[model samples]
Target: MSLPSTFDPSRALSLARETLDIEAQAVAAMALRLDQRFVAALELVLKSRGRVVVMGMGKSGHIGRKIAATLASTGTPAMFVHPAEASHGDLGMITADDVVLGISNSGESEELTAILPLIKRMGVPLLAITGRGDSTLGRHADVVLDASVEKEACPHNLAPTASTTAQLAMGDALAVALLDARGFKADDFARSHPGGSLGRKLLTHVSDVMRSGDAVPRVPREAGLMDLMREISAKGLGMSAIVDADNRVLGIFTDGDLRRLIERTGSSADLRALSARDVMHPNPRTVRAEALAVEAAGLMEASRITSVLVVDELGRLSGALNSNDLMRAKVI
Candidate 1:
């Protein structure tokens, strides 16, 4: 689409700034009006044994869907149901245990108000988010939340601009209140979003990403430096763990250790004569397989190392992982 010949860059920028200012003020005004009514809405939703049935019309419906998603992700059971569809048999989705949350700018949206009586007859509590507390929807509501705005940000005062913003803010306010009331935590949020990065950081364990069994680089304490280097190179973990006959972790030797060893002994020294026990750093950083992968990353970062040895509760060498493994798993 081409811009109109009369389109003024300064005018467009001014309108954009004014729209944001109007929306910001609308939300701020709603915040000031919050009182016992807002509390009633929160308590109503919290006490319900069923989900929150959100309903709206037109632009409000679009906001309702987003609100429902936010509520569901934040530990609240909620879903959006189009108000217009309610009259078309979609009303069956609402249970008696559920709470009906209606959104409208005028509080008399035809599609939304038409079902207010049905919702009430079903013995379900109604929560209204609207501009007019005296309007039909608010009159039928068990709890009314005022989402009023002085005017629309639209130049003609016709579009649902600030009004819709207020409705969205009210929905977010309810979700956040209910989330805190239920003691929702970051881990709970991550569980709902398992495919997200937060889930990888919180749910992934060391055992889930670490190389185990023969794949782990390990050399007995009596092993020669040549064998130790071979294990490190073969495992490609940039390190090798030194263990005893019982496979209990004794120490770890990494590329850094090898570099410092060579630098200290000089090229003329007999590097072949060094044993695993003589070159390895004793009691190297180790993490339990059951621990979170993020915890292993923290250990490596704090110790200034690239890799860490995984150990069992008995301190036996079980697996190994490096920064690369964490990056692959997206836990770092």
Candidate 2:
């Protein structure tokens, strides 16, 4: 067709949507075709003590990186090794206990094939994810997971679109299966991703972010309001726990309470005359020092408070955390 003088925006969008629909169907087709070979591949990876070395070339290499990341974050230790790099001595990273996952749309990437013999010689298990089950790479692999697609999303039917999507999804399936088999929990995932918000929610304990001991803003029940404000200012937690002689939390005096008290009594003389017990909000929210930081965040949000007292098993004050702590730790 000749080019139109003006562009047809709807036609261009329809073409893009058609491509996505084709790829989506290709992935859906894979679910029904998953067989025993997929199980065997997962078993090989899970049983290996060393990491999974994922390798590919061209577009396959991009997908390989994502697969490796997914595997590493989901209890399976994995890293991407380019086939070209492998031929240049990077192959030493692979160990006998590791599994080699080679991805190829045509099942015949020459760079990948060039290093397969050496990987095989090292006694490392070889797994192939490819569009062709009868290709040389598939035939040589110990286990093959077919990632075939009927057509490419490319208008010319040449680009690696649907094929790579299938491969990526298959890799995810393998990683999740290994994760379940290994009984990998959220805490385990948090350990690997400690720098992110998910890690803060799962791995950060109350003790990790809470203010401890004397560092906690606290005042005795009989202490004057000025003394309580001094403690709050020094600790900078926006609230002070009012404890008794035994150091057990009796009530909490917060900035909000202070504001309300000031509104009612027009003088600093009246505020100074008030004792901790006289101005405090009794039975303030508290959390155990061992609780998850995420739990603390929920308690704060539910009570519409900015801070909570961290207590021990016996209900004695151990530490304190406010909205600031949650923000700093990325738990919120």
Candidate 3:
């Protein structure tokens, strides 16, 4: 890396701070400006039978794409249609049932203005987020959200900086309000984003990751210590459930238990003589298979245990899972 001879670090830092201050003030001003118009916009979108069709040009076009995505993920059906594309055959994408949200910093993008009349003619309600309510886009809009910023963060006031920030803030406000009105929840968001970490945590259940049947380590109550140890080693769960003939869990034996037993009895104790019933801890913590994997994770953390046994409604041993299972499933 290298710096030019004219580079001044302090000047760069001062300008960066000023830019943030300007953008922050713009967003704050917008909040104070909200009124019945914003509410009307929300009602319009909520009442629509079709999607919210977002349209913009250039920098606004980029912001529109993001707003559309946010609305879609948060339970509102929305999509972005570039104004220039709408001028072409893409105008057909807008239906009478849809609500059109046009975004422009100056409210005077040539491509956007050219399509306003066409959108109005389609009988779709128009909503505008722009700096000038007197501008052509605003005049055609049924609801106008005043996103006007006093100035751009750029020193020359030529870049889209602060104005774009205000536009983004407006988009976020709409998405959040609409989500609340529609009763959209974290689970709904998770369904739209199944590949994300939050989706895995909310959607994965204990039954999906637990080891069951022959994969679960278990031994009869009368099993000797050697038999219990073999079951643990073979299943690789580091624990074995002591069950009755009917498969009801009687107790649990783990590596932690074995260590504690060794500490109490010392090396002189005859380990080979002990049976599963003699070594197991009774009334172990267990979770149902249908419970969320995160719940099992919570139980393990709260109890300071590494694994938990899964049981059916009748309290029979059904499965087993440990920290490793949660880790592999990315639920931890």
Please report the candidate that would top TM-score against the real structure: 3
Error of 2 at 208 (Å): 2.6
For model 2, what is the alpha-carbon lDDT of residue 31? 83
Which regions of candidate 1 fall more than 4 Å away from where they truly are? 1-3, 298-304
Give candidate 3's error at residue 327 in angstroms. Answer: 2.9
> Least lDDT summed over 10 consecutive residues: which range in candidate 2?
265-274
TM-score of 3: 0.92
lDDT for model 2: 0.91
lDDT of 1: 0.92
lDDT of 3 by residue, 153-269 (tens): 999999999999999999999999999999998889989999989899889999999999899999999999989999999999989999999999999999888889999999898
TM-score for each of the candidates:
0.90, 0.86, 0.92
Ordered from best to worst TM-score, the candidate numbers read 3, 1, 2
RMSD of each: 2.4, 3.5, 2.0
- Model 3, residue 235: displacement in angstroms? 1.0
Candidate 2 lDDT, 1-332, residue by residue in tens? 98887778898899899999999999999888999999899888878999999999999999999999999999888999999989898999999999999999898899999898898899999999999978878887999998999999889999899999999999989988999999999889999988988887999988899889778998899999899999999988888999988889999998888888878876555567779999998988999988998999999999898989998877789999988988888888
Displacement of the residue 18 alpha carbon in candidate 2, Å: 2.5
The clash count for each model shown is: 0, 0, 0
Candidate that scores best on lDDT: 3
Error of 1 at 75 (Å): 2.3
